[model samples]
Target: MATQTAAERREDARQRYNAYVATCPSRKLLDTLSDKWVSLALTALAGGPLRYSELARTIAGVSQKMLTQTLRTMERDGLVSRAVTPSVPVRVDYRLTPLGEDLMPLLEAIKRWAEIHMEDVEAAREAYDRCSDSEP
Candidate 1:
């Protein structure tokens, strides 16, 4: 039997969690990232830390329950930090952590790509529907 170095163990663990594998833990993270609420919240916080009410207002159409749930999930995943301030009304603020900051560029790029290509996507969808209608 041979002892593995720390780097080797880390690399082994990384290799084990392939997203393409059905049981890989990275799939869970991928699911989180694909969520609309998560993307919106992360991008909203990119400017700076936002109070809970501000976040709620910034992300219109998100119900209070969903917003709270999304924030809690992000916090648990170490993507965001929550701070509590003692005052007349206890204030809670959310800001992205270093790990979350590192993830921003990828999410931002995805957002940009989506915005840029949406018109093309819509045209494709319309063409597909027209073909389907003609075939039927």
Candidate 2:
């Protein structure tokens, strides 16, 4: 078999990337949004702007470092905005941007689906647990 040329390899990579993006556009977005801290942060900000400490308090089980990183990533993606106040204490606030607002309905739908199907999910989990217990 003949070896592929550099141009051919590049084209192949591009095609594969395009295919992956087309099939899983929401996968990437979901990966980001599904993160516990990110989801909680978005939910909290759904109401309005909040200070960093306020977010930290609202989102239980999130470490300060993880919250900071999640906020930074969201801000970089243009999903959230950060405002800084020039004061003696240097206050900072975070709020959802229009792009982030667009995700609200999607999140709400997911929440609804989860609520509706929770019993089914629980039953599946219990069945899996029983099968696993029986196997081993």
Candidate 3:
């Protein structure tokens, strides 16, 4: 019988660690994607580039501060590209980068799933609320 060396055991552990990391979302990425503001902002940008005001208008209910913060984070993440063009006033536009484009399908699937299951989710929430309310 052959004995496993310590080096071989370490390599096996490293491989398992890498496999786990590959499947898990980074905290920052999850924070970005799970934000309500981020999701709405990405969806609005999906229509094509939009000016700040256009994004603000399209997203509805987003405060200027929240939108600005979300855009800044997205820009920092390389998920969005901001352009400023010469105009009567400085024209600023926001568009998705290649990485952002890559995320569109995933976002779209999430949107579709939410739309399809919202009623079910709401029903579950209501049932839970009723049960909890009755408990004490």
Evaluate model 3: give its TM-score.
Answer: 0.80
* Clash count per candidate: 0, 0, 0
TM for every model, in the order presented, reads 0.91, 0.74, 0.80
- Which is the leading candidate under TM-score? 1
In order of lDDT, best first, we have 1, 3, 2
Q: Comparing candidate 1 with candidate 2, which one achieves the higher TM-score?
A: 1
Candidate 1 on 74-126: residue-level lDDT in tens?
Answer: 99999999999999899999999999999999999999999999999999999
Candidate 3 per-residue lDDT, tens place, 9-54, comes to: 8996776555237564354578689998999899889989999999
Task: Name the candidate, 2 or 3, with the larger TM-score value.
Answer: 3
Model 3 clashing residue pairs (backbone): none
Task: Score candidate 1 by lDDT.
Answer: 0.97
| Tens digits of lDDT, candidate 2, 1-136 | 7899999999977776562575855557667888877877888899999999999999888999999999998998789999999997999999999999998888767777888999999999999999999994
Model 3 segments beyond 4 Å from truth? 1-25
Better of 1 and 3 by TM-score: 1
The C-alpha RMSD in Å for every predicted model, in order, reads: 1.9, 7.5, 6.6
Lowest summed lDDT window (length 10), candidate 2: 18-27
